[model samples]
Target: MANELDGRVAVVTGGASGIGRGIVERFAAEGAKVVIADVQDELGEALASQAGPDALFHHTDVGDQEQIGELVATAVERFGALDVMVNNAGISSPLRRGLFTEDLTEFDRVMRVNLLSVMAGTRDAGRYMAEHGGGSIINLSSIGGIQAGGGVPVYRASKAAILHFTKCAAIELAHYDIRVNCIAPGNIPTPILQSSATGEDRERLERFEARIRAQMRDDRPLKRDGTPEDVAEAALYLATERSRYVTGIVLPVEGGTIAGKVMARKAGSEIPANGAPS
Candidate 1:
């Protein structure tokens, strides 16, 4: 089989698990040397080993500029060159906590991890890619970025910033042939979602998850929730030559959820709350 990305070197932040892991796997399968950068030592190492010789694990805290720089350096040193950078490392605000009483520290943490880290990684990685001519930068945003999520004000703001930052980077780097794009995913059932749920938050989260599951299966037009693979495929397209002319665009991998609101009612099943069929 002809590998679309044969001989390429790709760096994926948060590559140890979730959507980032999927992107890393897809890239490696296409013959790219991958660097998995994450704070998760055990999982990162395990994933690297499973991905074969072309994969390297760099225990990195992406929010730290020094660590991000080192991550880029490691990729270039090991692979001879850098061709793609996926700024996929991120975190969400704790769930069941209303915005009013939310701690500022929690907000800062989310901002640093989800927003500032993308900025740092892209800046460092872009320097390398530009010096070598060009490459692709994929930033992870979310549906909540475009739409409002009631309780997570900080997360919403950070993601919204990510989308705009991607456009700005694209404009500035296009001259160097470096393409920057953002991927906005919706309702991906990842550990990140679960991590947002805590002991006190469990009941509310359970109900929320139930509502989401119902929407995914019978409420949405597609009748399904999106998987990590959906977002990975989008990243793959954006990273490869396939999107040579694509840049500065926020691509929604949200299964049409972003395009249209799917209420908990399909054509034949939307019964009125008043116990009457409309």
Candidate 2:
């Protein structure tokens, strides 16, 4: 049997590290010609090198429309066609220890990097993919989009917008055979989360961890932290012909996070708080 993505071409934004990097590697391993698009030149180039000849690195800041256009142009130039575009470029503001106000500038930056960047990449790459041939476009959303995020309001809002954008675009591009989808990831143990904590704030970070586990306890039916490969597997499904019938859907790569919510409520009822409840 042939590999799922054999001979296909894939473009992943922010492919230098974390979830995007994992997706790029998986796509490459499946035999897709991958493009690593990120602002981190050294790491991106290194990653591309390790991905083999089929992978190319382009220094891209998705917040810049011109750069995104160039990124698409580079992919087509190198690989001759674009088959899958994963808009995974994003960043979070510095995490707050507790309920703290965010800077107005940070809010703007979050919106630009998380939301508008996806819009730009999707618009350009979707058109390119449609024109070349029908392809898959995967937008990286977050579990926060569907739930409340107290620490990162802007990040939450931006991800929420991306989910809607994925839906709206899926409808518009269906005519062209370009399937658009979004993946909402659960609490994955990525550097993105670790970077938010400070060495001096160990207790604060521990509290944050407890809260995350609590949230996820009810949030996911599966009691565990997600991995980057988990999300990549979902991307593979969306990118390949395996899911040819699926389009414009938001797949929660959340390991029962979405599925286990109701069951968790029942579980909570059965195991009531020892000191406070009946």
Candidate 3:
């Protein structure tokens, strides 16, 4: 799979950093022409430079539907076609005192960026793919969406919407050979966890982040920590023909955190006295 995406064209939203950046680099290495869309001008341009000529940086605010449209148009106009669309731009809602006291002030912005953006990207990209013989669209959700909990409730809701929206879009777009899938990543350390916090909530967010880091120490089924590259690998699978028949599914790259909590035990606790059970 050295060049699994050879001759393909891709557009990755929020490709300046974190998980998005990883996908951009990976896709480029796999021989795909990529458009890195993000509002972070400097970082985006720098990344494009590192990714070589096949990668282009486009200033895009995914919260603005118009910008999203322009992103797709630019990709096709510049690259000749759009084969893979990665909707990875998003923001985390601030932590409130509680759901009862939650003002839901960030509701509109969070929903617009996280949920609506995905819909628009899928539509704009799918429209071209539909007529261009179909392609793959990967939407980035989160483990928070699949496993409910407190804190960042709005952010979680927005991500949860993407899961269903992706599946629905998959069903509707299948006739055109387009495959739509969602990737829910968790336990991957990123600066996104600290975004959108205000005042005292900022301190709380730090503590919450610390708790997450502590939990990831060894609690999950997989002992090692996950990385942006881990999620990028999943994106690669969906982008290639290996997943030609796969669509409307949620792939979790969270070290099996969503499956169930791992019970802690001593290193040799599981071994029986006989030491073997053939």
Candidate 4:
């Protein structure tokens, strides 16, 4: 897909790591001049440097609307136009015992980082795309948002909000020829997971994560873990003209985890009269 995004300009938030980094690299490879927006100066700069002249690193805290505005303007000033906007910066809420023990201390921070940033990115990017002949906006969501589960309730709510917002924005932006969509990634191991933990919690998290991964391997139909590149590929599809007709959709790059759990069966097993495997 070399040069697939020729002459295009893309801005990806949280481009310093994980899925966001993957998208930045992919976009640069496809011939798009990309702006890497993130709070991690060192990592972002290194990634931009590695991407060569087509990429630029910009320090941005998407939680601030003014900074987001600046990021959009920076892309236009440097690259001439903003053709794609990726609202990929997100943080996971800390895992707690249960709803009873939850104090919701990080509620505001999580919403600001995960939900408000996406809204601001879409609105700001849409304003530009609306007048400049339209463009694509890809928002990152998670499988946790799609399915109701325990643990990080706040994060789930924020991602669920993103899913709905993307659809609503798509409908409203359609008149302006701007496209809005979402990519919900599942079971992709990234550093973001570790960032949510501390000393004791970190140890517990590791064990919990291991158990979850083991279960996911059995539950997910594909029997394999997902990668940041998997989500990036989905973003690329939404970013380019290939999906011109597609909008207001939640694309799950979850290895069929949302489809249903894989049914276990023995090799050459036969069903008995009671419908049990023999």
lDDT of 2 by residue, 65-184 (tens): 899999999999999999999999888766665555555457877788899889988899888877776899999999888777577666788999999999999999988899999999
Candidate 3 — which pairs collide?
none
Candidate 4 lDDT by residue in tens digits, 1-278:
56889999999999999999999999988999999999999999999999999899999999999999999999999989999999999998887788997788999999999999999999999999999999999999999899888988999999999999999999999999999999999889887666555344667878877887887788888977899998988898999999999999999998899998788777878887999777
How big is the positional error of residue 264 in model 2, measured in Å on the Cα after superposition?
A: 7.5
- Candidate order by lDDT, decreasing, is 4, 3, 1, 2
User: Residue 269, candidate 1: how far off, in angstroms?
Assistant: 11
Ranking by TM-score: 4, 3, 1, 2
Higher-scoring candidate on TM-score, 1 or 2? 1
TM-score of 1: 0.90
Candidate lDDT scores, in order, read 0.87, 0.85, 0.92, 0.93
TM-score of each: 0.90, 0.87, 0.94, 0.94
Give me the displacement of residue 42 in model 1, in angstroms.
1.2
* Candidate 4 weakest ten by summed lDDT: 193-202
Instruction: For each of the candidates, give the backbone clash count.
Output: 0, 2, 0, 0
In the order shown, what is each candidate's alpha-carbon RMSD? Answer: 4.7, 5.0, 2.1, 3.2
Candidate 2, residue 220: how far the Cα is off, in Å? 3.0
